[model samples]
Target: MPTPIIIDCDPGHDDAIAILLALAHPGELDIRGITTVGGNQILDKITDNALKILSFVNADIPVAKGAAAPLLGKLVTGEEAHGESGMDGPALPASKFKPVEQGAVEFMLEIIRASEEKITLVPTAPLTNIALLITAYPEVKERIEKISLMGGGLAYGNVTRTAEFNIYVDPEAARIVFESGIPIVMSGLDVTDKAAIFEEEIQELKTRGPVSVMVGELLDFYSIYGKKMGFVGNALHDPCAIAWLLHPELFESEHLYVTVETEGKLTRGMTVADRRKKPDQPANTEVLLGVDREAFIKLLFDSLERLDRQLGSPAGES
Candidate 1:
């Protein structure tokens, strides 16, 4: 049976690709629903973006709108990287699929409580909704299989000198989830930065089909921020989370006890990973530390091709 999961995201450029990657593999993952959080952009924009992306791929998945702000702080957006609409590359047709009325936290609780099998949570943006779900309804904790997420890095940061954008947007929520005693697989920037598809690959992907062509355009715009960071191409940050869930062997990880710094003045949102050789803190997270970039890129293209086949678009038509 396919592993049931919920994709909680903000529909950032990479987040859109992550959803496409998961949906392309129906046999491997059964996505119960997709819930939007306020991260890359505002709640309304991202919720609509989710619907548009799903419609773009002809998927009929449930989408729920979530928190518009963080638990305790003002919301910080990634408009710098994602652009004003959150997904700012190719023009997407307006989606006929609308989000369900239930809020993200409530929808997640209901799904977890009602599902016969355990459900994994894949969060690719700020963790406010996950924090709210677990806190407001702590009883659902046992039903969650695990949380595979995209945030945090022990190596360095993007928002501040030590914080990534997602965590930095809502560090308090991140701290709560990190301490919630749930098993976690973290696809932090430690490995995500290496999961890049360069210009050559992007050019090749554009010819695959409509979906691949749009993905190529999305990367073209998103790569601007990556270029500012001195990368040859844009990093597939959000897709790294899904990639690890589907193909763990393509990457390497370290079992570490990690926590988000919520109160530090200059270090807030930093993932404090206990990497000491003989430290006594029990490991809590499988932190992805490296990836086979070639294999990662191949997996990405493979997903695009599969989705193209599903959409019935002829090869090399885009």
Candidate 2:
């Protein structure tokens, strides 16, 4: 049986690829729906980008818009990275899928309550939407199998000198999710940065076939922003969470007690993972520490190629 999952994202460039990966690996994952949050850009843009990307892949997943900001703090958008449109890569055809009226949090609760099997929550953006769902409907907590989120870092940070973008955007929400007692598998920058998507791979994506070509164009557009950020290459951040579902062996993780800094002015949104020597806090998350980049990228590109070959064009491809 395929693992049923719900992707909560902000449609960052890598988020686009994450959707494609989920669509490609049908047996490994059953996407219940897509929920958009405001992190990379804003609620409207992220929702639009979610539909656009899924449509691009010809995936028929429903989409819902979530919170426009965090639980208590002002929403800090990542215009520097994802651009004004959230997903600024290749010209995506206009989205044919409109967002449902229930909103992301409600939609998440509805599906989990209705499904007989537990649903995995893969949150690749800020935790606002996920946190909201858990808080608004505490009864559904038992229905959630786990939350696989892409944020925080064991070592470095991108948004601040100590925090990653997703968590940094909404530290309070992150704090709630960490303390919510649901099992979490955190695919932070610690592992994601290790899985860099570089130029050679991009070339392969371009010439490997037509589907590869589309992925290549998306990456090409994605890379321009990366170059400006001194990445020298792209980090498959969002996709790492989806990849975790398909290929868990590519990454190394440790069971640890993880908490979010919600009130500290200097460390807000920072994941306070207790990687300490002989600690007493109950470990709640499997925090990924490293990844086999070569294998990881190979899986991604190959999967996209497979989808392209099968469908000929993205579902929304004109």
Best candidate, TM-score: 1
Runs off by more than 4 Å, candidate 2: 277-280, 313-318
lDDT of 2 at 255: 95
lDDT of 1 by residue, 1-318 (tens): 999999999999999999999998899999999999999999999999999999998999999999999988688899999999999999999997999989888898889988999999999999999999999888788999999999999989999999999999999999999989899999998999989889988888888888899899999899998888788877899999999989999999999999999889999999999877655678889999999999999899889988888888865875
- Enumerate residue pairs that collide in model 2: 57-315, 58-315
lDDT of 2 at 276: 70
Count of residue pairs whose backbone atoms collide, per candidate = 0, 2
C-alpha lDDT of residue 183 in model 2 = 97
Query: lDDT of each prediction vs. the true structure?
Result: 0.92, 0.85
Error of 1 at 244 (Å): 0.8
How far off is residue 265 in model 2, in Å?
2.5
Tens digits of per-residue lDDT, candidate 2, 215-300, equal 78878877887798778778888889998888898889999998888777777778988867555567899999889888998898
Question: RMSD to native for every prediction?
Answer: 1.2, 2.5
